[model samples]
Target chain A: MNYPNGKKTNNKPVTNRKPKQTPNFSNRGMTLEEDINQSNQAYLSSGRAVIHKKPTPVQIVNVDYPKRSAAVIKEAYFKQASTTDYNGIYRGKYIDFEAKETRNKTSFPLANIHEHQVEHMKKVCEQDGVCFAILRFSKLEETYFFPAKKLFQHWDRQNNGGRKSIPYQTIQQEGHFIPLQYHIRIDYLSIIDEMYF
Target chain B: MNYPNGKKTNNKPVTNRKPKQTPNFSNRGMTLEEDINQSNQAYLSSGRAVIHKKPTPVQIVNVDYPKRSAAVIKEAYFKQASTTDYNGIYRGKYIDFEAKETRNKTSFPLANIHEHQVEHMKKVCEQDGVCFAILRFSKLEETYFFPAKKLFQHWDRQNNGGRKSIPYQTIQQEGHFIPLQYHIRIDYLSIIDEMYF
Candidate 1:
């Protein structure tokens, strides 16, 4: 259809023009990241668990201090992280792990993980810390909790001519898969209880 | 003695050019922060321990990922952290704690710590993790590891009309005071082996 100004318009009514992306503030809806972050915060606030995501590594070269309370990080470069994504105390044990999301339907590719992260996980396990990776397939809307040991086995086999990814069937068979609930977004510890404890 | 500007009558001046202000960098080749960073890295690299100073918490407001590997953190703000400075793995146990430096000779004022950090330490201890604080006296160039159990007692007693800060005498008597050595740099794990393990 043409408007008076001769601009063509789709006759269909425009109820939803698309949502503007919001920042960390929860004003907008929450994503999986936000849900886990809130759950972690709830854990901390209630003295249940003390877990936190290490901030994304950034090599801050220049900082502008317009005000003492607020320093603007300027001219910063991203740095490769040397450790896992999340770590903290849970039920008298140290918990450390990485979280990844894949859209693939068949399997989780090993390329999603980095060499340093694997090494970090190995060290954490050796140090008697509970280490693992949380894999979420958004397409499947399913999450799986695979202990670092399993991931290590798969990682090592990749070097020995095995597939460079963990097949979904193998993961379902060997991994302690976690179910997502509304309140507990990731709800990983539940699986840990059944698997480890 | 008078020295002419153009004519250096005397090769040696009575008052040598005010000895170049010992550069902040020269007086100490590396800042205390740098030294601690290097020590922590060595700990992580050698698999002796895994300790890291949490990067300053940044609230990422915007990002420009012009390339796949280059997700530049464009605008961010530094947020005050609620927990301690450093934490990691040591001796098959989860180690979590903070580091503080003070120039005060009489006492390391409790004001150096926040209420939230003390609470975090307590939670870490309850989880059966190793939690402590590394105190450094910049004036004396000394470092000490004060266990969380002892720290919690002092922290709690403050609510019952006790001293706010643990005095240096008490720290020396109760805490495992780590002696500064040339090669060891902030050798804390040795004390851990002797005291805890």
Candidate 2:
């Protein structure tokens, strides 16, 4: 296709082209984690909330400190996380949640959520902390803020010989949809305000 | 010197000796991190609070995922943590703190803490989250729960040509001493209950 700026559609790799300054609303090719991270940066800068993704858990078996350089990990293995991926404080309340994305448009598979994570969420809920899941249906391009209580119910039902996944229609009814924005890609705080505050 | 287990005072390199089943109150050779982790586990099991120390941050540059085998990180580097080492919920309130130990008996040096961590504590305090530091003096064998506000005061004062470290006497007066116990090695939540609750 011809370009609007009077340039031909160049198939040659445009290595020197500068990145776009403004964000494109329709072109959301970024992963859910990246979107959430960007949104968290916006929230933190705006003094709305203070959320951060925990680093990937790694078990270091051996490390070498050579001369005056930085320590380098020689032998390490990734460890499974025992808690949710994201946590912080908002409006004097503790917030905790896990983010997950699936390509299945019909349902969100139960396998996406781990048992220990559910247990962690249960403990947080018992402590009266706000715990939930940010589930994204990638194929459908829909993201929802699903409550931990509802997830627990479904998890229990699955353990009791129920369906292994939550249907999209059920999620639409029970969960709050998070709309994308320019600055805050996934404005989940607005949903929290409406639901909790 | 000999132990009270009726064993001879033979120094023949006892490598096969069994670990003690009961905790010793006098001999605390474990690091402050281990002590806090043990305390957190105790609190979690008793359903008192849900606190966890964050895993050490690392930057992975290369990984090898062989078939039917776990992923092995071939190259990685240690990364500086942007936030405190530990945080979680206690009594429906957000709790955040950093645990640090000093071998020097005079003062807890500011060099142990990073600038970004102080900024993070500032943000957490602004969000009304309970923030503090667990300072331990190895020589004195004392641990104290120093409030974030107090730390910030000293931090800012140091920036304005004040002392670079907080004096040991100052910590004794301003901080709450965490007593070592058999079950909950470092009973910090007790101090939290007294100070915040």
User: Evaluated with TM-score, which candidate comes out highest?
Assistant: 2
**Clashing residue pairs in candidate 1, if any?**
A92-B127, A127-B92
Local accuracy by lDDT, each model: 0.71, 0.85
Any idea how many clashes model 1 has? 2
Tens-place lDDT per residue, model 1, B1-197, is 23223332322221222222212213144345665676777777788887778777777787778866767777887876777777788876777878887888878888888888987788788778788888766665556678888888888888688887788877776676554333345567776776676
lDDT (Cα, tens digit) per residue for candidate 1, span A1-197: 33344554332211111212112222224455665687788777777788888877788777788855677876677788888878888887788889887889999999999999998899888888889988766666656678899999999999799998999888777676554433445566665665557
| Alpha-carbon deviation at B14 in model 2, angstroms | 38
Question: For each candidate, what's the DockQ?
Answer: 0.37, 0.70
Model number with the top DockQ? 2
Which candidate ranks first by lDDT, i.e. highest? 2
Cα lDDT for residue A193, model 2? Answer: 82
Candidate 1 residue B101 Cα shift, in angstroms, is 0.6
